[model samples]
Target: MLLELKILFARQAEQQLLQTTRDFHSCKQEEGQLVSSYVLKMKGYIDNLERLGHPVTLGLVLGKIINELHAMLKLYEQTLPKNNAPALHVIRAVKVKKLNKHKKSQPQMAAMGQNHGKGKNREVYAPKPKIPPPPKREDPAKDSICHECGETEH
Candidate 1:
């Protein structure tokens, strides 16, 4: 009976160790989560593993952190401009409108035939007007000559 009990306890300990190892390996930093918090969470897992008689090397921890950071950098790069251009140029290149939650409910009201009046007096949904881009100004140096040098460069 004593030998059987010892074997059962050993098997349980092994299973717990395996589960802890799996948890540590599968941990990942979520989007918008702070790096410090992610690191601390990983540290907790590492501590648990250590308590379970599993030794974690510093190199392994560092490698996992570096790999995760690299992945996050790649994701950030995908959202930003690739070229070394001014942010204004990027903003001007894309035209995006903010979506209003209330605007969506308005369409549903229209679909349900909630017209306030008949014919000309009925409420009609008009598409929002597009905003025109700002007027471009010509460079003064391109048309004006320098008083001392007689050149357009200023």
Candidate 2:
């Protein structure tokens, strides 16, 4: 009887572990959720998993956080105007794994035995400079011209 009871308890523990693992894997940040709250929720799942004898690495947690943040940023971009988009600096500081390639890589001509005058030889990524829009002309008469009707006053 004691052996049977022990086996039942072991089965129950295994089931609990499985459920916890499922919960951890299925956790996702909902739309419009704050980043801090999402991270806290994930941390809670991590804690639960750890308590259930499953170990999660710090790297895994951080990667998960970054992935969620990246997804949120993309969603935000679609809804927000181009001018309101998040700055590249913030994303770079977060060290997100992937970014849209804005600038093409070009090989620089360098002389032999010279490291381009820089201490280290490495590729640098920089955001493209923003150019202001051309100034608008203030000719009301010119603006009033209609090609189809040939009328200066609409």
TM-score of structure candidate 2: 0.53
Clashing pairs in 1: none
Q: lDDT per prediction?
A: 0.74, 0.72
lDDT of 1 by residue, 1-154 (tens): 9999999999998999998889888888998899899989989988888888887999998998889888887787678765553454434333222222223445565688874455433333434658999887588668788889898856
Off by over 4 Å in 2: 83-154
lDDT of 2 by residue, 9-29 (tens): 989989988887787778888
Clashes of 1: 0
TM-score of each: 0.50, 0.53
Global local distance difference test of model 1: 0.74
What is the Cα-based lDDT of residue 131 in candidate 2? 100
Among these predicted structures, which one has the highest lDDT?
A: 1
